[model samples]
Target: NNRFTERNRCPADIEKNLEYITLIWLDENIDDSNESVQMQRLLYKMNNYVLLYTDPHLCIDYIKTIVDENIILIICASLHELVLPIIHSLNTVRAVFLTCNDHLKLTSVCSEYPKVAAICTDQQQLIKSIHGTIQSMSNQTMSFTLFDSNKQNSTRDSASILWYRLLIDILKTLPHTDQSKNEMLDKCAEFYRFNEAELQKIDMFRTSYTASKAIEWYTSECFLYKLLNKALRTEDIDLLYVFRFYIIDLYSQLELEHHKQFRINNNWDKLIVAISWASNFKR
Candidate 1:
């Protein structure tokens, strides 16, 4: 009984507050006569609240009759019905809702008003478009090939360098299985030759030189791995010591990036393993 009393009182409170709030309820089966009477009374009272409940055919008429520019249009039936008029009246209105159809129309509307647009679609295309535009503009302004097809091919060259860096880093962590080690060496040599040949075709001396340097670094890393594995298997102290000294010397010569933590961790692991193996031989 108390709950029922409170519920009955709620509507009167809502009506009192309706003057300060704009409410629109849309439905196909709305009682038109009753709605018009109630809305007319509210208008006569200068309540400042607007309400519309009508089908798509009567939407334009319904919108014109409502005096409040600050109207909340609730779209309950067909989205096309709501979207068309709302878009037409874009100059007067602030916001809208389309609760029905999910189609390209929603996306088109949202694209026009991004701030109030809630339509969902393929976001990847939007992101790609933004990135491409920015990249193109930046390249044009700076006069650099950010995504160049030719002209030293900075992007591709940098990518190749990063790839070799990763391979070398991975090789240092993995334990030496003789067959796997041999396969790795063969692949390194093959890829290095392929990349070096491609770089030489570019006609940019600096790019070719950088590619050559990368090839040398990768080749040396592969050779070092093979030598380390061989020394470990044969318990050759002289060979292990020579490879260790060679690694130290190579480390000094390389202009490695400060952010190569992955490579540094792998190298540290390999160094520890080498030290352990050497101690075992001494014992």
Candidate 2:
């Protein structure tokens, strides 16, 4: 019954595990008495902190190599919005600690992600809150025999699907130059670990297009709507026909005020060509 004894041991020794805290001090310029520094010193004394002195993006890269689950992420307010998306994308984080006192923003963020349990600006309270959160997460994990593969796989697959959907939407709508497109594609490959062949499948003609086309499309669409209003105002059936069957059908899209300016400028030839180009646009 030695195995049983070990398994049933009281006051479990979590120190034997890979459990640790990740403290990301985002701002390079911070006072000595700042909560980030104070919290860092407090966590350092606990001997459980892994101080990351890197930018949010690079820090995320380092964190990606860690396959541990008991990671408690403590990030500054500036890095919160930037790093949080990456953190949520991973299934490793057990809890989150923020060095922010903005109750309104914290309340909204906490509501969005329940794992964000504490938003502390004071050193003493931050330490206590962190310790308590770690303890609760540790206890919760103790009840489980091991990592839940099914849950992790589900989370990962769902995230991948959403990420892919977003990229595909970007490809269809958001216009980017070749350089930007290639960079985005490269990043996607790196993030998803896809090889060249696989990346090629997603690349298609989407990345080859120019941003000017997208801008023109948006401006044309806005212009068409603007012209449609004018057509209605002057009871111009011919103008309505030109818009319905030609202008809008031919030019692609614009912003509100800019669209007004474009309409006033009467760039009818450009609108026609844009609409024609859009009509010929292929996936």
Candidate 3:
């Protein structure tokens, strides 16, 4: 099943995390109320993958399944004691927002764990805090592995880096086709099922996209940007393969722009710079 199950219900574990942020909401009162529905809609605006769960244990299990993305967990005050202890130690669980009142109890808990954000009793305050925290985390450095050739234990890391470089090269050479573009848009629509704003963006892309505007779409920071950024950052081979349609266009457009940067009066401008032979680029 897709991430957004019927009525934002708890979904089965996703095999991997393919995005920068995931907001997991664990509360017993996730009923069909205006407040709950509005809160969830706001959260979706910040991050597309928002999971709703009533059972603390099931939520924790889902959290454990995520690897590449940072999780922003929102849980009811009642479940904090049982859930916080388990999630606090997990590196993926980056920020935790505890809701409901009892400031005295939460202040003590917050002191013990700095990762736990401020206690948000009011719904508006909770959303504001979550929005700020998500913005902060988005700016924070993403997870990546460094490969050092000098280290003997770097075999795996180094190989993975090489593999990624090779994969990019192969994708750049693949023939772009209408079929590939359709596949990409279909997958995006599936993943962003309940996200109306992103769906509209996707629809626009389907009707108006062209290879010349590949970089524009990539940098728009819309659904395409979020999905592409995640796939590249996580080195998700399967997802990257599906994104081949846009990747080739991105490469060709970059090449076109690079060529244009040197043109003056119908003649290519000469560029001069000093760098050692060991530098990655060669003239």
Candidate 4:
């Protein structure tokens, strides 16, 4: 159900656009005689793309090839060992490295090769950076949980809680202006999954459960819309009515002009329909 996993599948246009010139650097020693290699060879042969794999010891030679061809290289190894050689070789080509390390060494490496663009890291940093950037754009201050070693929790649970807290903190900083509220609401809808426990913990909802609680606590229908939409997508009927009531309330309060403005700005039919229904809701 993770939208991220679905979004990362390489599109056909990407292959077509880079078909003639792209090269994929893979670790050949992974399984020289396996179906994976055979399929890779077939792709290379059909598309005239380049594929190379070398032993960890012979990585320097591969680096030389990468530099000589000015090829976009993707290194399939720990960045601690590969960063030095890659920096030595390619002066201008783009590179992506897959790593599990928490060290920010890749940022330093990117500084050496300004052309060497993306350094894909673990999911935690990626999420944090994205949330940080969005909040910064709005000139809002938000705090994130720093998972120091002394925390009394399992690593997995701690990481999850940290991310959840970071997201909640960022949401709290969004401005009360309709434009800002709507933008934040849409973003929350896109990136977050709502849970009752998480909602109850917000300061605005600490008192009671009512239609007003959702709007007062969450600030906008966008979050409610997203929550209901997600619940519907997952067929979670139990939480549907809470979100449904909020959406109906938001629609009733907005003027016709406000609805038009929202539609023009967002261009999302689902949101438009939700707003319309809420605006026209009767007792």
Candidate 3: misplaced stretches above 4 Å? Answer: 1-17, 141-161, 258-283
Error of 3 at 11 (Å): 6.2
Best by TM-score: 3
RMSD of 2: 23.6
lDDT of each structure? 0.37, 0.46, 0.71, 0.38
- Compute each candidate's TM-score over C-alphas: 0.25, 0.40, 0.80, 0.26
- Where's the lowest-lDDT run of ten residues in candidate 4? 137-146
**Candidates 2 and 4: which is better by TM-score?**
2
* Runs of candidate 1 exceeding 4 Å displacement: 1-21, 29-52, 77-87, 101-105, 113-283
Give the Å error, residue 229, model 3.
1.2
TM-score, cand. 2: 0.40
Residue 51 in model 1: shift from native, Å? 2.5
Model 1 lDDT tens row, 72-164: 444443544445545455443434444444445555655555323233233333234333433433233222122333442477655544543
Which stretches of model 4 miss by more than 4 angstroms? 1-29, 32-47, 65-68, 86-92, 99-108, 121-283
- Residue 136, candidate 3: C-alpha displacement in angstroms: 1.5
- What would the per-residue lDDT of candidate 2 be over residues 65-172, giving only the tens digit for each residue? 555435677777777888887776576676777876675667778877777768877667777887787556534432221123355357654554454334333333
lDDT of 3 by residue, 117-233 (tens): 878888889889999998788645322224433562567765665675577578868777888899999999887777788889999999999988876776565776677767766
Clash statistics: count for each candidate: 0, 12, 0, 4
